[model samples]
Target chain A: MRDRPATEARILEAAQAILIAAGPGGFGVNAVAREAGVDKQLIYRYYGGLDGLLEALGVRLAQWWQEKLMAGLPQTPVENYGELIELLALQLLHIVRSEPLALQSLLWELTGSESFVKSLSASRARAYGAWMAGVRGGLEPPEDVDAPAINALLIAAISQIALAGRQADTIIGLPTNDPATWDRLEKSLLRLVRGVYARP
Target chain B: MRDRPATEARILEAAQAILIAAGPGGFGVNAVAREAGVDKQLIYRYYGGLDGLLEALGVRLAQWWQEKLMAGLPQTPVENYGELIELLALQLLHIVRSEPLALQSLLWELTGSESFVKSLSASRARAYGAWMAGVRGGLEPPEDVDAPAINALLIAAISQIALAGRQADTIIGLPTNDPATWDRLEKSLLRLVRGVYARP
Candidate 1:
């Protein structure tokens, strides 16, 4: 018999592959089992069912993002809020570029009606809230700056641009699929964030 | 015998209703015929087929958006770019709030993998490009500003917030579903665009 933990990991990986490759429609037990080379019954025995498996996948993805964000965070607090803002923007862009599947999951969640998606969104908000609180403690925000709103705008912009780039290489005259375009975008985003947070 | 023009209009209306209510999945020829109380053969005879019907729906939706945007545009162009920027932001926010079906169609297009979706996006890009050209003609954009990039960011942010608000009422601590929250968001977005384009 296959080792239990190994088999479970394989199943989860297979499920994620299917989700990224064919979206929700192709995420069936039969397809996952075939991809993982495991018995379909093991999925039921280990995870209860498809919904349960999806929940587990969601949990795994969330943990992955948390860990990635934490890794990119500054080791110690910085004196300049502008520098911090730039760092945060770059880190976010990096994560979006590196984790295409994660971005897809996020875009999928926007239209998804599943309870799992709701809980995942809530958890992400809480995690981000905590991070913002930590950053706020160390940095002095400008009088007009609404830090959370700016962060939300930044995240939403990055996510949408990356997702839309897949089909439409250019949007609003920006070359979304080109590396030079992304570099320019990253620089412009950094400048924009600094401009907002810069003291009068 | 039914009037050809009237029957075609009815079919198109039925297709639009289906798109808004059930999204693309429910926009099949069969469902549309049932919704319109028309014979299945009538759809084939009126619009040629499903693809033709969809193209007609796309054209209708595009026309609707162009009219709405034109109605919202300033009758006399402002000399100040900052005011123009704020006006554009508010107009975009209004469009997102007013056109729920259009927003749904946009989100569906993001996840959709069809030739029709691609052509629709290209057409939209062209439409927005034309609008931007007209706006640029009257007002001078800031030297540091990349108008298209800024426009893309604003559009993406609005679209994501509106689409995600349907599933999760709050994102990154922003209360998306509440009207008061949107008021705050609109003001903040105006400030952001102005800050980005403001002269040194």
Candidate 2:
């Protein structure tokens, strides 16, 4: 007898592989079932269909992000706001840069599909919010700082550049695909972070 | 007996419609050919198939941005760097929020597809650089400022928030989908812009 939980996990893994390989265009029932080594009917019978399975994939993604964001980092509590921003910014960049799956989720989120927005993206945002609360510790930005908005802008921009940086294509003239160019971007990001959050 | 330029133009418009409505997943030769009321063979014959057509779409999109960014604004030159940032930010938000095609392009670019990266994105980058040069009117950010990275970050973040805000979705706790929340985001964006470009 197939292990139901194991089978379900396998299906999700296959879905991620497919997304990483073929993107959302190739995401469908028959292909996912084939990838999972299961019958096509099983996805519907098991997860209630593609949207449901996609939700599960989203949940899995949230969990993956939760783990990966903290993976192998020093346990030392971040010293100050600048340090915190540096940690958050650098780690976010590293994760998005290294993982095609992370990039996929962002791209998928941009589609504004109800299934993804309601299920997948919601799960991710919740996980991200919780993750931020955890990592932020007792440290806080200056009172005048619109920390959430500023951080959001920085995070969004950095992620966008990283997405484009994968190619030789430029994001507003930053040749981010080049390693030296990427290094300069990193420096500029930290500078902006430090500049914005710098205490008067 | 059709004007070749007009026929090609119609095909491009249809492709843009498909991209705007269905996102990239619905973008295909058959669909575009049908939308344009042209034979499928014409697509292969005229534009060298989808990639060439998409490149044209990118060029057309660049022209659209160039026109729309100054669509009905006052002829008065942007007096300072801060004003320029505000004009650029607000106008960009309006365009991206109202125009699904812009959002779609960003999402497609994120997919890291070679066809998209090499052609469509290159066209976009050129237009964006040209647009920036035209708008700035001799004002410059402070020497300490990393204008490209900073502007890229703000633009990236605002576009992202706009993308998510189409639905009642939260981007890291800001309820961007809500109009009031979005207002605050805009305010925060301007605040970040001013803070980023503040001079001694």
Candidate 3:
């Protein structure tokens, strides 16, 4: 019945809250059921248990990223190509910063059991790669820029930003969340993009 | 006597093993003593207790980073310029790839009860700033390069590379630890350095 789907969603929502609160512990069917305000049996029937619920949550997160990244893709070739690259960087940074849960889920995936990796397609990976490729394509290059290596470096740089968390300004002696910081990041990223595709 | 120092080191070593094996929960003093093959009271006597030991560990880790980063200061404007930047990036990536415990410790510091941020000092910040300024001074910029922004971007990018972990390669669609990856990273970095500071 319709109640079954509703019950499943409620359980997942409760599970996320619990996961965030407890942090690698405190994930239990009883706790989730209580938080969801549903019968424990209903959770079991809906999600097949805790593992099923977590698997579902992971899939949901991946889909969320896909949609978010695809929001402002370039539809044409002549619209300030550099702006497109900056927009994507800003959008990605905004999503990761605003939704701490997204980063948390990614961290969970990194430390997740092998079964979790097996079940999920590397959708997040693909999306990030495509984005990088787009940035490379948009570059206004000079001779001697190495495209492939720049792509690798950009990937490495972005990964570091994602993992360093938003508080890097405090940790690394920089200002946190300043417009200047984003401006610096975007300009540097463009240079990489341009550097990669510049004619040798 | 030297026995005291050995006992302290043994306690710290044991703490590391226990934390790795059992996660943070396994860090009880008694457990650490058992793992270290020392008396539990000795742990209290030397490090004062669990919290104290972790504090010491943090200081040791920070000291290690300071030494490693300062290992290769560029001696001349020409010699120290681009290579210094590459060396910093390489060292950062190596640490993030190999010693994940450092990241774990940093993550804990953010959420930790002990307030690690308080440990950051103005003098230390100035020292770091001075070193960065020195690195930048070696560069001679092209007419169009945004030198200050480029310097800031490189520092942020390097930190981000360290944070991204396995996701770096996944984002870039390459293997994480390949020599080819580092080569690409170096090239991209060199391009950024050159783009920002190369004389026209």
DockQ each: 0.57, 0.52, 0.33
TM for every model, in the order presented, reads: 0.90, 0.87, 0.74
By descending lDDT, how would the candidates be arranged? 1, 2, 3
lDDT of 1 by residue, B5-37 (tens): 888888899998988888765579999999988
Candidate 3: the clashing residue pairs are A147-A196, A160-B160, A160-B161, A161-B160
Candidate 3 matches the true fold with a TM-score of 0.74
Candidates ranked, most accurate by DockQ first: 1, 2, 3
Error of 3 at A164 (Å): 3.3
Residue by residue across A153-196, what tens digits does model 3's lDDT show? 55445544554433334424545567666566666666655543
Can you write out model 2's per-residue Cα lDDT over B97-170, one digit (the tens) per residue?
A: 77777777766666646564556566665665665677777888888777777777777777677666655467
lDDT of 1 by residue, A1-200 (tens): 56999999999999888877777645689999999999999999999998889899888777766776666777777777667767766777787788767676777578667788877787777766555555645566666777667777777777777777766657656776678788777767765676677743
Error of 2 at A156 (Å): 1.6
TM-score of chain A of each: 0.87, 0.88, 0.69
Q: Rank by TM-score, descending?
A: 1, 2, 3
- Which pairs clash in the backbone of model 2? none
lDDT of 1 at A84: 70
Local lDDT at A111 for model 1: 69
- What C-alpha lDDT do the candidate models reach, one value each? 0.75, 0.74, 0.57
